[model samples]
Target: MRTCRTRAAGTAVALLLAASALTACGDDGNGAGDGAPPELEIAVGGAADQVTVPDDNPIKEALEEQVGATITSVRTPENLAAMLAAGDAPDFFRLNRTQLDLYASQGLLLDLTPYRDRLQEYIDFVGEDVFELGVIDGKPQAVVRKPAPASYVTYWIRADWLATLGLALPTTVEDFEQVLQAFTTGDPDGNGSADTYGLTGSSTAFNPFAPLWGSFGTAGPGRFYVEDGAVVNGYTDPDTPAAVEYVQRLVGSGVVDPDSFSIDFNEARDRAFQGRAGVMAAGWDAMKKQEFVDAAAAAQPGADWQQLPVMSGPAGDGYITLDPYGASFFAVPASVGEDEAKVDALIDLLNYVSTDEGNRLVSFGVEGTHYTADGDTLAALPALDEDGGYFFVYQLTGRDEETYLEVKFPDEKPFIDVAAAQPLTLVYDSLVVPPEGYTASDAERYATEQLVQFLTGAKSLADYDAFVDELTGQFRYAELIDAGAAQLDELGLTD
Candidate 1:
């Protein structure tokens, strides 16, 4: 067994995989006696950590072993700035690309250029696109975690209900409303009760009503959109009101469950699983889980849920907003750069995970002990999930995409194909802005909230013209989209 001395207190401990199994482990077969520092503690953002971190679990021990150094974290999100001011910062941190500008201004981050050459091995492994995520203003500011899993939202409907009622998946806005009518009044579940609704929507997560915005050629629920070569808020776009009218029709006609308007996302999903609704919005990743599959199966003996094609309407091409940002990325504290040894240790640990072997270990744990595989299909041994190794990614940095796809969506080919086939589009993420003042978030808030009111008859669509005037006048809404378009132009994302 190889032993690494703890970096913090200069004590030795063995955390390597069992010597009997680790034939290709990266350690040099010597402890920290070679003058290598002990472990370097790091910070991972909630975004990246949403999926994982080593966290002193068995995975951390294994990672430390592979990199020939100890690694540790103190879970520093709540007090990171204070920690940095106190010289107690983690060696690394994770953040969105926008945050790079702020940290650079505050001198809290290490400019990653000096380390870029050193990161060539990783860049080569994952490609420049993943590496570019770390770059802002033409310099690398952080290590961006890469995404490769087939995760996207689906407009899932009760296939058994559609089959039972001889209904086809709705392809246009009008068709959808008709189907919702049937779903509400047609007794599709055949349970001999009028206890069902045609459609359900949620107040959270990738915005469940986002597709309605898409049907009108608005990429998302945000205020800013491009129309006739000019940036305009959704309230100004004629189709925006049309989309609202469709929702109001559903609610006014008694096709939508009133409870869905305020229920949590999970509860809304439960409504679909319990066979109480005909159509719903779901993410592909969450839908593929065995638990969700079982939920649908229990609704009926062989009930199936399938994704509807991206529906179309009068204004734009069919499209759905795929959140441009996924939870991932990490940055080294400026303090870490002062110590050459710590920087190299950080690089070594990251470079290790960028490779296939390291990514698998980070995600699945020990081959024989944490999981077992046959013919390329791997299953986590009971202990792996029990010990929490099944959830850690060590990623906020480099990730192996192939491993992620195989592990996260082994049977998602059809689901992915449906997403790729979606039509007419609006992508509100193009207009990224902070929430507080003069931003897309504020605009989207007004738009979505008004939509809810209009559906409930608290506000009438007849007054939509006044709503448009309010948003355009109060928010400088046109200027916002113009600025966003300029940003896209600078990035060559807009013509």
Candidate 2:
């Protein structure tokens, strides 16, 4: 009888395998024996330090269960040229918009046109124009995630400081200058010393002074374009001279830090937190972060930090910088030909994570085990020995407006609702064509090196025409425009 039971169990396994094979023709839902699903490897970019992976959210398990394939992940740094050139490249990886042309020219990424129709849901979620950023030389090369509002730079101010000084928030450039002066001079902290500076900001290389330059009339460098037939480049335009002069004046008057060009993003944030800086420009998401808000509150109790709308420019225009959709995106390697099973499996895995249920799993972790949900409120679960470190794993997939609201800022419902109601607009109506003959890495390196000199008065602002001529000569903007012209023409913007 014991021997019979062992033989019977083996027979049952064989029968189940046969059944799965036959049902694979239809929606068996078990995702077994459909086809030889290829293993996929993906590389991503962004806050890698903050990402946490749970055992349950393992890429291999998720992909295998959802689509009968295995997937692995590698966090690629922003500097990925060496990796891309190597023979052992991952199956899929993320690349910046500026770098797409270089990779596509080298035949590194697969043409996604064949799969365009299937990705309609994704296209719709991230607006059409924002989606267009991923297209290179008329081919859709990548997927877009988190299409941020363009030209929208918000300044957060200490509201309690204004109230204490018996002053109102500044609306115009002149008024803003006055406010800065008051913050620096008027013992705003009641410390009886003139230790406070009017304003402090991150170094220009990371977050350029484009917004401040825009307020004076000239769009900052890298900010102008022909959107719907209007020619605009904020930095080279006429108002730029005045803006440059304004910055010079601010530095000369000692109201702004002369060493502002040396500070990094984190250091600038620390300045604000330490109650030394009065104003700064940041994204809506940054303002919503607990660290930033808490920092200001801790430094000055009852300090009401208010988000300032983008300031009006001399041209009477208000603009905000649009955040790039998915600082980067995953792309299939050219080696992965049109393998239908592998592609299907890949799509299924992506679809699973994009869904509400899967999103909650990675974002909130196992609700009863890692967290408890009370109606709409979610509370943390007791610490688990297997729990990963400080970072949350879900952020790796990318954040949507809905997911962001659920996890980060549940208390700021009114602000969140308003943001949902009034979505911010993109800044440059026309996309600045990435320069030709240069790799994305090259552009980033150039921008990183050149922005500080340009902003800090180290580069001469004399002879505005000459400066423009020199920049055009060095970067070959004309060639870039020519390369991008055909695409711009297709969009019906370039007549």
Candidate 3:
């Protein structure tokens, strides 16, 4: 075992001296003649139940041995700005790419560019594109956490209902409308009542209409993507209005459920589960979760929901939108830059977890205790669900989502595969940060309300131009678009 002198006084003094003081006390490992490893603080993001890691956590113990440091995990403080101002910040903390840009610009985050060689393993594991999310102005100011395999929302329909109605899977926009018409009027449920609806989904903005927008070769409103060599917001795209028109017709035709305009995601899903709707749009994870699967089975014995491909429209076929850039990132306080030993230890910790052995350890826990491995399959024991909530907190680098999901929820593999195979509208919407003076919440809320109104005939389609004008003019959406374009250009992401 290596030993080093404590630097309590020196650490406190250093903390007190820094301006915009994002500092925390931990062993710097710089004392003469002892040759000891540093003690590092890692700030994880989440609420109390989610982020807490007990002292006796075996994964933490195993990781400490690999990284050659004493690890202290802390929840990201609620009052972060005050903590930073008081020089009581954690050594490193979880943040999103947007927050990374803000802190990097304020000179409150460590630039990891100088230590690239030491962090190569981590950089390679998350891939270059994801790692670049942490880079600002050619300097790596944070570490991007690898995300799971991209998940996209797709249409799911009651296959049994289609069979009962003597209809094959819809392959085009017109075909889909025909199937929906049958589902609504043909009494596919065999109960001889007209209680069924053609479609159901959350009324939250343009999200519920992703496939419809894709049929028109565009994404949902507020999504920013490159088209014809320039960045453009999806709401302002020429194709969006046609997509809106299709939805209006669907609503006006009386095939869509009225409750869809007022319900939340779960409520809309319940409408599907309870046999009130024949179709729904949601991510596979939600649709195929064991609990939900059980709920649907319980509600209707013969309920058989299956993936429905995005129907082709005038422009072309399109898939649901996805943010290629993940939301999780890790940042070190600029104060930690002074301590080279500590910085290297942090890199070592991240690198260790990216290794196959370390990833398995953190993801599944002790092989025989939490799970059993046979070939590439892992069968979880009951103890895993009982005592392993803390394991996820240690998955700082993230796991291969597909493999992880397969191992954890084997029954959902078929649905997962179906989702993986579907086409998608890759959008970089998360990269756009709302500029100062822009109230995004209000703007998004208004847009959603107007969209719902347009869909339900509460507002006429003839006034759609006025809606766009208000969105861009009164909401300062144009400002956001301008800022987003400039930001993407600066990052070399604009095509």
* TM-score of every candidate relative to the true structure: 0.78, 0.75, 0.85
Q: What are the per-residue Cα lDDT tens digits for candidate 3 across 1-495? A: 122234766676776777323333333343111356677777767542365578887888888888787787777788766665555678778876667777777888888878888887877888887778778878988777786555557789999999998899998999999999999999999998989989888866544566777788778677888776688787788888888888899989989887777789998888899999999888887788778889999988889999886788888766666776645677888877766777777888888888788888888888898899988788888877767777877777777776777777787777777777767656777778778889988888888788778877888888988999999999988888998898877766765
Which is the leading candidate under lDDT? Answer: 3
Against the hidden true structure, what lDDT does model 3 obtain? Answer: 0.79
Residue-level lDDT of model 2, residues 306-379, one tens digit each, is 76655665756445445344364556655454356666766665556556555555555566766677786665
lDDT of 1 by residue, 352-425 (tens): 77776777777777788778888667775777656543345365454555555455455775676676556533
Evaluation by lDDT, superior candidate among 1 and 2:
1
- Give per-candidate clash totals: 10, 17, 0
List where candidate 2 sits over 4 angstroms from the true fold. Answer: 1-38, 58-63, 77-87, 117-124, 127-133, 136-138, 149-153, 205-211, 284-288, 326-328, 338-340, 354-399, 413-462, 481-495
Q: Which ten residues in a row have the lowest lDDT in candidate 1?
A: 25-34
Q: Give the top-scoring candidate (TM-score).
A: 3
The residue-level lDDT of candidate 3 at 220 comes to 67
Relative to the unseen true structure, what is the C-alpha lDDT of residue 24 in candidate 2, on a scale of 0 to 100? Answer: 68
